[model samples]
Target: MQLISTLATIGFVLPLFLALVGVLLARRDYGVAAAWGGGVMMALLVALAIRGVLRGDPDLPHFPSGHVTLAVAFYGGLLAIYLRGGLNRDRTAVPVILATLAAIALLEGVSRILLTEHTWVDVLGGFAVGSLGLLATGCPWAVRRIRAGSRLWLAATLAVATPIAFMTVGWLDGLIRHWVTL
Candidate 1:
């Protein structure tokens, strides 16, 4: 019980605080990206909520945190964008991103080991899926537009759709989990 409480507290505090920092940093140069990140996070939360409703999981509100994944993803994307500038060609950017990702994974792993959550796999899976979305959204065309500051519309779309995507994923997971039990 103490472990769960500690892990939960760590899960909530670290990710939430980092996300705020990420938003502020992104907003300094990429307001749209920051806003988009917010939108995506919100949508994901809603979707998770819906899934809990369908699954009749009374502890839906107490479910594992997806915001951690969001925090990692959002910051990861921003880092990728920043590195694209090639300010340090001799330096590696991927490693930095990977390290950040690994840190998040470690957090989740600790959470699971502490029994604060169900499994490390779920958090890792969320991290992978979230990163894929971040990569996809940071493609050449997307990167160019974001850098050029001409893709406000595209950023807005991402802001709106990412969360919806997360919600849908949560809903499907809930359905499948319930189905499997039967």
Candidate 2:
């Protein structure tokens, strides 16, 4: 259980490190950095919204695992795009990213189930939602838009958007807790 949680937590936190790496690697072109920043922000917001909705449904009987969703949407999605040359165009990253994502998915999925944090249905739903959210943000058109956006704007957007999204999720989580207690 501890090992599983640690893996899930690592999977959850890996994207932030990847974003920093993207920044360091952005000297040649900021497209990849911009994509990483923008995609993650988008994924976080979408995952939070989905989590809120799932928690609000009294009859739903399951909480879609937010941790699992977040790990997949940000880590899995970003790594997938990076692997496909959407970001770095580095073929060498393919194996590394693929292995990392597989490990994350396995760990997160198994942990959520073992801990009874979510049912299999909930975990699967989270995975699907996360994947779709990533797909939406990682599309060619979205990538082009992110690449075309000004670097200053991208930086500012990430700075502001990331915190707001997180705060919103916190707020929503609280609201759901209150509702349940009521």
Using TM-score as the measure, the top candidate is 2
Quote model 2's TM-score.
0.58
lDDT of candidate model 1 versus the reference: 0.46
Candidate 1 clash pair list: 47-167
Candidate 2 clash pair list: none
Identify the runs in model 2 with alpha carbons over 4 angstroms from their true place.
9-25, 59-62, 84-93, 141-182
Error of 2 at 176 (Å): 16
User: What's model 1's lDDT at 178?
Assistant: 75
In candidate 1, position 43 carries an lDDT of 35
* CA lDDT of every candidate: 0.46, 0.56
lDDT by residue for model 1 over 109-141, one digit each (tens)? 455536655455445544554555465546444
> Which lDDT value does model 1 have at 23?
46
Which candidate number would show the highest lDDT if scored against the true structure?
2
